[model samples]
Target: MPAAVAELSPDAPAVLLAPLLAQFAAVARLEHVTRAAVELGMPQPTLSRAVARLEQELGVALLAREGRTVRLTRAGRIFLAAVERGLSELERGAEAARAEADPTGGRVAFGFLHTMGSEAVPMLLRGFRADHPGVRFQLVQDYTDSMLQRLREGELDLCLVSPRPDGPELTARRLGEQRLRLVVPVDHRLAGRQRVRLREVAEDAFVTLEPGYGLRRITDALCAEAGFTPRISFEGEESETLRGLVAAGLGVAVLPPATVARPDVAELQLSSPGARREIALTWVTGRPLTPPAEAFRAYVLSVRGQLPLHS
Candidate 1:
């Protein structure tokens, strides 16, 4: 072992160096024992001993004494950079802990697909906020896969997604299922029908979301099962945009039943083997949720019946 690292015994517990690290950080910043100690609200000798102990623990001399002012050794500069980041992270963690402990109000980072934002999410949040008026929410709107990625990265506490994400790293609870309807221009021939089979649309052009959205995947699967690849006329990000295109006689689209009804468009039931998308609340397994997040999850589960869906 290097002499600097060897100064501290190999058997010494790693946690014991925390205070010395703080002390060294202070001294390294001031480059003067008396000033660092004054800033730390400690005696000069005490601060001096702390730095000496840190050097001994690391088995290296962290500082070079030049009569009065001390300068950091090469190893000391490298160690200081790491310590700054680590200590900053620790300080952030402490602030988060305090925020989570606030009994009056807390923040929840909630995520959901763009499709649900129009009606479903607004309804859910409205009811939740009535009871938890003090609680604040940060809304993240994205497609299914992107939302799941954010959940795993700890950016989102939980997400409202469709088709129920499947992976060992994620845990999902089905809230309810939203039946997809076939939308067509009001004057289109199929608009007069109450229901139609997927194969009936084989000859029609379709408007759909771009690839990567769960709805698009469902659209592709249904078209494949219907024995024909859809003739896609338009690709978009929002369901409302797809609706507008369908209303303008651009092409037909498959959208959730709760989608906004336009005078120029007609929504007909589309029959398929699995004609519905499952809406679920998904979170990363083994990651702990904040108290407010946990409470909101329980509340949402209890009120699944009130959500927009077929009973």
Candidate 2:
């Protein structure tokens, strides 16, 4: 909280504008006054006072205190929803202003999952940079959930993610689907098959991604649907490690076609209904897309035809 926010009263006219609304939204998001204060780089007390003043002006208690934790009241929940819409609109306005000032030269931050980091990302960036050289790109690599959260908080302009939750605040466009293949050691009996059924591989030892990773969940679901539980051999995060384990004859693994792009591993198509994962580009709905983000999205769609899909 700062001295200025602390001094604000319910009757102040400035409380009705965008800045106060942004502060209220941040406080609502963090819940803790201190954490919200830290995010805003203001004194906690000042942030608390600003929220207090906003609540006063609205004639509603925005938050309910339970011990040290704060939860939103009904009015607060409603207010927060409105604040999200308002803030999104404000962001769009700012973006529009920036575009008016300079249509092409602006900074944009993008985040993507590790799975898409190698070829897809590079291709998209290269095509975008070729078209809009003046637009600066800031790339971030992170897991799916963290990337989505950052996008919601306005820290990222765009993100590439798998199918997940959707709401009025966010929009998604399909990039394309990637086939999930079975990777086995070269000397393994299954390696000679053109395509192996899931049931055939059900009893085989498996190395897979750790829980919370997108591919892990997909593999688990596919195995379950095939009426067999995978024989767990090793759990890890990186797909490269999983592939290496398979190549070393430790166990078999399920991965996207792109995962086996290297020549070291053998990729076999899975039968009994092969599995595929959808990839998409997502951003906050109604938020104005920066030139860089728009260009990247366009390039991804343009190149999507080249992506492999299950027959």
Candidate 3:
């Protein structure tokens, strides 16, 4: 470390050094102590005292006085470079914080389950934007556990998740529920049924979302309630992909209702052990939200009952 930097106490508060650094920068810029004081709107003696205190703290003379003018020592110029860089970074951080808090033009980081992205999320965003057109969003689509991890890490401001996760670190508000469907290839033995008990498919091989996904957990719980574990044949990341795998006659799957009908597959409603996933708006408990994020959260709650969910 440089002699000046080495002299700075590690425990010293930055608040105490910021103003002194600002004063020194002005003096270095103008190369005149009294005139710098005038520019900073302070009495000349007070500025001189502040500069002296800074030099004492650093154990180095930063400026050499010549009558009314001043010149930076070799050490002074080096320190000035570091000070300017730090100040620039601080200014950028301040600007970003201000922008985040702007009521009319702020940003919100939002996350949701991939299953909702096809229709539900788009409809929600369109509705929210119609009322607060200036608000911007950063969207993330992932499985429930992954989105909740990001939410806890402060990477996400709000999330739309399902199965209503519970934790002391999180706050979840139930918005609505989506009915789960049993999807099978059109030519499969049970495809002709409009409703079937989950236990009826217990012996059938199932293609489902990968573990850790909210839907997969719900599928497991519902199957357990119906008195059997589903026979696993394949696992997938996306709900639509699982549906496509079903269409190929790979296996059956429990999934959200399809947004559009596919001639290759049949969707049956569950008649037993109610196959419904409750959707919730979730956030980190006690974490303060920026203006835009709070506004978006409020708007979502207001229209909770109107959220689009396909049958």
RMSD (CA, Å), each prediction: 8.2, 8.0, 11.4
lDDT of 2: 0.78
Across 23-68, the per-residue lDDT of candidate 3 in tens digits comes to 9999999999889989999999999999998888788899999999
lDDT of 2 by residue, 100-139 (tens): 5775677778887777777777777777778778877789
- Residues 103-141 of candidate 1 have per-residue lDDT tens digits of 457888999888778777898888888888888999999
Using all chains and alpha carbons, the TM-scores for the candidates as numbered come to 0.71, 0.67, 0.70
Q: Candidate 2 — number of clashing residue pairs?
A: 5
Candidate that scores best on TM-score = 1
Which residues of candidate 3, in runs, are more than 4 Å off? 1-96
**lDDT top scorer:** 3
Which pairs clash in model 3? none
How does residue 133 of candidate 2 score in lDDT?
85
Global lDDT scores for all candidate models: 0.85, 0.78, 0.87
